[model samples]
Target: MDVRDEAVTIPASEVLLPADLLVPAEPVGAVLFAHGSGSSRHSPRNVAVAHQLNRAGFGTVLVDLLTPAEDEVDAVTAELRFDIGLLADRLAGIVDWLATERPFGTTPVGLFGASTGAAAALVAAARRPDLVQAVVSRGGRPDLAGSALAQVRAATLLLVGGLDEQVITLNEQALDQLTSRAELRVIPGATHLFEEPGTLDQVAEAAADWFHDHLHPQPASA
Candidate 1:
């Protein structure tokens, strides 16, 4: 089925985040994406994975974590992305808005994050346990989630690259902090980006299964 698109304008401090909502023909759940520090809704890897998720009957919201002005400042100063607290707060705000706002009221919500965004995603889920149902991260720096890890009650799956030894160690360290039902899957022969052939598809498949397990099911199925 062809994926349909819609523009969702989320209010930030003085501006709005221009997010593209990708809807499938019969979506079973929705994922709110938090891309890496340097990445945005425009990241090809994320966009491709969003297509895969859409084909699997899920909707995707790829929002820019930073506004144009905020991004410009971070680009030169290179400081804000590390402020995981603020990013996670903004992500939580978006989730709350989805519940109270007109277009996205009460949709089954999940988080798909990568790199620094994974930290924010975990933090947001920790802060709002009732809203976020599950989380999937690809080649992420989940260590940055910090103390928020103890509060994440949702199921979380962290996909790390086997060859990226440094990040794998970091993920292991962070695993100790997480009290949630969490698992780390290391993709063999994959680097930080998992850009190696067929590696990313493995990430996508793992993500699909995780969401399928945790997302709200139909009455009959449940």
Candidate 2:
């Protein structure tokens, strides 16, 4: 089936966030992507993953959590990027927006986050347990979510690069705190960016499988 793409603008905490949305003729679920520091909906790496998800029949929304004005200040201060509370609030707002939008409102929703965005995703999941069905983090900093880590109810997948040992340890610690179903998988020979040959592909495949398994279970017919 052919995939349909659309440009959308979602309101988040008084900012208008630009996003790119893709949906198959019949989608199993929807995944909202929260990019890492210094990245946006235009990120090539995330766009690749979104394509994979779309092929798997999962609609995807790649959103910019920051407005153009905020992005500029964040680029200079590098502070907003790490503000997990602010990021999480914005993500929760987007999730709420998705729940009220057409077509997308009925579909199960998941989250795919990278870098510090992972922490924000976790926090948002904790806040909106009714809306977020699953979550996947790529080379992320889930540890930064703090005490809220235990509150996330979504099935979560944490993908890390084996070569990134420090982050691996942090992910392990975060995994321990998570009360929900969670698993950690490390890709060998990859760095923090998963820039090694075929590494990002592994991350995408793992994420797709996880979302497919957990997001939208078939309902029994009457």
Candidate 3:
């Protein structure tokens, strides 16, 4: 695909977050992406979604929720990514940093999270309602979010694969705790990873549209 944005790096709480900063030549808004368990800024799936969002004229940030050393340990034991509190706090710090940063300062922030990262993203958005405008989750473990569910004020979309029965049920269980405008979507013929052909792209497109529709300049365009 053709390049449409610049990549940048920033310091998170404990780590230097490597990010793929996608800026639409003529940007509309911005979203930060949180990958699933054991994934990083280099995840092809998240990168795919970022590409779609960039094409839709939205800026995107795909960054590491953990530091390099932490990620190395987490990648093997899958322990670091499970700490929702720590991850969410890191995400919140990143948002604050962006608020003070350049181009990102002018854009509304949204979050796109998958799997366990979805919970972290939700918690982060909940903690900083003044920053995040909207949120989207793909095959997420919202139930893992615990009480953070009720803290989220941003409009949220939870997308699950049709065959991801367990995760779907978990999301349903988690929905009752949410106080925000939230919806659950099931993509047909998809598995946990949504690796069935174009299903992943479908997910990416859906997320981009959701963020675009829900996130906008504050005070509404009246």
Candidate 4:
């Protein structure tokens, strides 16, 4: 099961975002990851989840959502990361890029988002319903997606930490607005980051299973 790892620059929303892409041989599907606020493509949590997906034969894309200059500004104001519309626009562009790119052009695509990135992922899914097949949110702020929540057509899975009560309530509200196939699963003993022992692994496994179950399987090659 050879996996090709590439350090690439993706053109999204008129910006070039650095990303890490991993494609396993005969991948069943491909998933794009949107990191939370103050996080990059190098986020350890997302990287761990990507590796889990890779082992499950799913290609993964982890791209930085903001440019260097914007990141600098965001670091100071901490506002850009909370700008759901801007993030969604870039995420939607990345989805467009993935749809037309080589190897993944025809692949079933899914999205994995954490924290505020989850809202962007949801908004992007609503904007590109035909291209996106499934979505998973890890301790995310899906409520920030607003009215777009009702427009999402992808199979959505919301994973929240059991101890994160506020987010859980928000997710529940958003869950009711989702018209597509959706489910909410609370990870026991997990907090916002799932930093507890074995908690992150649970997130990884659940995400892999959801993507596997929802993303259309690739045809067997001769």
TM-score of each: 0.93, 0.96, 0.93, 0.96
What would the per-residue lDDT of candidate 1 be over residues 63-170, giving only the tens digit for each residue? 887889989999998798888987888888888776677253345889999999999999999988887999998989998887888989989999999999999999
Sequence-dependent TM-score of model 1: 0.93
Candidate number achieving the greatest lDDT relative to the actual structure: 4
Worst 10 residues of 1 by lDDT: 98-107
Q: 129-183 in candidate 3: lDDT tens per residue? A: 9989899999999888898899899999999999999999999988888899999
Error of 1 at 111 (Å): 0.2
Candidates' RMSD to native: 2.6, 1.9, 2.3, 2.4
Lowest-scoring 10 consecutive residues by lDDT in candidate 4? 98-107
Model 4: per-residue Cα lDDT over 108-200, one tens digit each:
999999999999999999999988989999999999999999999999999999999999999999999999999999999999999999999
Residue 134: error of model 4 in Å? 0.2
lDDT of 3: 0.86
Q: Which regions of candidate 1 fall more than 4 Å away from where they truly are?
A: 102-105, 217-222
CA lDDT of every candidate: 0.86, 0.92, 0.86, 0.94
Clashing pairs in 3: none
- The candidate with the higher lDDT, 2 or 4, is 4
**Whose lDDT is higher: candidate 1's or candidate 2's?**
2
